[model samples]
Target: MTVHTAPAPAATMFDVRNPGTGDVVGQYPVHGEPEVAAAVERAREAAVWWDGIGFDERRKRLDAFRGVIARRINQLAGVIHEEMGKPHGDAYLEVALVLDHLAWAAKNAGKVLGKRKAHAGPLNANLGATVEHKALGVVGVIGPWNYPVFTPMGSIVYALAAGNTIVFKPSEYTPGVGAWLVDAFSQVVPEHPVMQLVTGDGSTGAALCRAGVDKVAFTGSTATAKRVMATCAETLTPIVAECGGKDALLVDQDADLEAAADAAVWGGIANAGQSCIGVERIYVHTAVHDAFEAMLADRVGALRAGADSGALVGPITMPSQVEIIRRHVADAVASGGRIVAGSGSIDGQVVQPVLLADVPEDAAAVREETFGPTLTLRRVEDMDEAVRLTNASRYHLAASVFSKHHGTAIADRIRSGMVAVNSVFSFAVVASIPFGGVGDSGFGRIHGEEGLREFCYAHSVVRQKFASPLPLMSFGRTAKVEERLGTIIALVHGSK
Candidate 1:
């Protein structure tokens, strides 16, 4: 007898287009709710095997994964450049940053998550305590199109290093890039599906939040984050949202005009200003405002945005963002701001870098996240006013301070989660520094020791070495023991 089952219906499909030319770069499966749920279920099984391997063994596999990425760095960079329309050099730089983070997470995970002894006070001298960060089973990572490699790796790598299995949902615009990453990891650790990919749009991400994953690490706009949070709330699933930011750069009177101008331009316009930490506003002290403005104008005048090989800035990845950029620039000019460089124009998906000066403090260009290659400059009386204006924004993911002498001092006064002094985007490159923000920029970190711990839950164990002379955990304690305990507590802590 021959028995046969009907072939499963073909999965839904979608096309990924290149923003630069609107050409079909690739086609991907549109993974829906059932597919997402199945991936998470598989991840749960993988998580057990991954967790049981222990940190030392996991480190070996992670290091091997890093080696594979390093060997094929240029190939991955090409995919990033093609899908996202970022310059090849910029794509390569972002990939290199990922390698650095991979090495850091692999090298430090054992120490950061490994069991360690905790101090037992004299009141509990008979007890020994140890704590370890255990993996939270499976994690769902929803990534953004911009800086797809670096941004998603910030969550994906850290989660994997912490021993949690991952089910990734890359942005719809960059599914090929995401697929490449997962495929590379498979080549290195072939035994288990420690990392997997599911490709789709916003609804797919919502499906992931409802797919029964232990935690969801999301990187996108603040508005989208709120929606994802709402979906996850249904299952009470914890989330880490790395959302949008209106980051700023503050220039003091004593700042080096050339260095500050260069940093501000690059920080604001690099990656076509799609970075969450990209500087959108600049505050200059009146003492050096004119000099800085002239320097900025001269520098900005030479840059261009195009689809050509030499262009520093490329086409906007999301076509819808081009109109948003237009609206912001129009609003800035209407609010009495002056455009000092490049015509505020959008042709197809290519948006020319627009620099506006004297923009109203309340204008959309200043208050909202444009996520485009636009910079708004405002002159203040001194560094104090600069800091005040910078801190006034609703989003505060990161900022940069440019002052020769008061660099660190000024950085300390900023309310952002991370700040770069004398340089721009420096904190992101340092794997040891935590990356996240408060308020509308969203909460939870994705890098460094805090990042490794983000995908884990603490497990504490206490062992009794001997019986306590006067046990507080027992019901048979007498009044004399209670009096002695009260006296010890008062003597040790009441004086303060």
Candidate 2:
């Protein structure tokens, strides 16, 4: 099928389509450099008005923004359901989760970013030092098509709450949802352009990075992240990359086979398995591998993909992803894996659920991210091997460990950002845990205290009540005082 490009603009806008039916959803402006530059200029003006409002007033406005989203959850979910082809209920859940993060950011921003007294130690106690977390200036956010609401909002809300103005570039595939969110925030803070939308394709994202924004926040593939970093490097723009994850799940022999199988199916197939933290591999204990695979096959076989009520799986969001999915499955099968459920093509967007067992370690299906409704099962001799193989991949985003007694220990050993001991995607729902990855999965964090700080910079300040008998910063400082300071520091923090 030929991919439909976005409608014509002064610049070419991306064509947004409904994945399940291949219907044209809508089109948006492909904002050019001039428009985005203007948006950032406006955002700067807005930041003054916004940052001056102080935390209390901003908190109220942010809360009102949350209400706007909460009241219209289903309406937003419908757009997500169509544009991304996630199940309606699941889409609703995604929107609701965004609202929760918005609330968390607003409620916690002051405490996290506010100026606070820091221990000056014996040396600096007389210096009256304090540490302040200040917002970085205008921030540029480049969003992804999958989980359009939840993903970008992770950056947008946190950035705004920390007093930074946001100029967002949403995925062209789901610009409507992005526009709706900005519009909702406007209703609460009409006085400032605190959060503005700059809709376009990769060029727009490129514009935002070089358009003089202080920093950029990106969520996408690692390959693209390297490019984004290179672009930002030109301007020395610091970036937070929340990229892809080839996450794994390790099952110990003592694990509940039924629970492990259930998690494997859900983690690999939810949202048609398009999640960044989606479970892509299963390293089952040899003792229980057969039982787990049998149960997984039974469960995954009953799953359906469509725009209908009975559908559990949904269409592939991006059309180009079709060939990628087919290739992964074909590679695994040819590498001696067996498909126990649906396989092959379905239509323009929808693809069938697939289960592969006995897949070789070197198969592309096991080693890379296919981002579709597929699972590769391999047996390991023991839990030790499970941990080793699970961490073998360069990507360490999220993982799950299912063991009745050793779940937490096994979870801690897996080298992923977040792990669920006996659940699936629980970290996302928790609201207080940091969400991000290590290595190829990308760096920086976007939830909890860490998320709150991602948008701010630390500042240290000191005030003197009187002329210090021991002065530092001044050329007049005595060498005798310098020696005393060294002794003081060693007496305090350097103690053994």
TM-score per candidate, in order?
0.97, 0.94
Candidate 1 segments whose C-alpha is farther than 4 A from its true place: 1-11, 494-496
Tens-digit lDDT string for candidate 2 (183-285): 7777887766788888888888898888999889999999999999999999899999999988898888888888878888988899988999898998988
Best by TM-score: 1
Candidate 1 lDDT over residue span 176-196, tens digit each: 999888888888777777888
Q: How many residue pairs clash in each candidate?
A: 0, 2
Q: What is the C-alpha lDDT of each candidate?
A: 0.90, 0.85
> Considering only N, C-alpha and C atoms within 3 Å, which residue pairs clash in candidate 1?
none
Model 2 worst lDDT window (10 residues): 1-10
